[model samples]
Target: MSQSNQQRIWQVVSQIPKGKIASYGQVAAQAGIPQAARLVGNVLRKLPEGSKLPWHRVVNSQRKISFPIGSPAYQEQRQRLLAEGVVFNKETIAINHLAWSS
Candidate 1:
């Protein structure tokens, strides 16, 4: 990706603070690219393992973690968020109380 496009994606990721969450579409929109929702997911998936970008705080439009059961990423993300007091309803997080500012 070009430097500018990389920066744009990072700009959106950087705005997501600790203990907060934003949907892919919202992040794309906030970055001034409304149609880049799936692109946002792709960019996030490509982030290096151990990035400080708070990648765990993002999820699908349904507010559920996307990784498959037993997957390391899924378990780690759920554990991390729960450690931060994020409440979940089965696969979905309670967005009304947990939705982040965009």
Candidate 2:
């Protein structure tokens, strides 16, 4: 993807408020690159270590963390969301209540 598109993805992710979540598709759409959901995930995955862009606030369209279930990455994402007051029903977040609208 283009650097500008990547930056746009990051900017949208940065705006996801604490206790709120956004799907990859939502981020891509908000970044002005509709239908680029996978690109959004790729941008987030390659975020530099120690970057503070709130990457964990982005999840899959299913309202689930993209990381493998029970894995360390999954656990970390879950913990971060929990710490931010996101309520999960089983493995899925309560998306209707917590999804970020921007």
Tell me each candidate's RMSD, in Å, in order: 4.5, 4.5
Local distance difference test values of all predictions, in order? 0.77, 0.88
lDDT string, candidate 2, 1-102, tens digits: 556998899889999998889999999999999999999989988989899999989999998999989999899999999989888877877644645534
**Model 1 lDDT per residue over 30-70, tens place:** 87788888888889888887788877777778888878866
Off by over 4 Å in 1: 1-3, 95-102
lDDT of 2: 0.88
Models 1 onward score TM values of 0.80, 0.88
**Ten contiguous residues minimizing lDDT sum, candidate 1:** 93-102
Off by over 4 Å in 2: 1-3, 95-102
TM-score of 1: 0.80
Clashes of each: 0, 0
Give the clashing residue pairs of candidate 2, or none. none
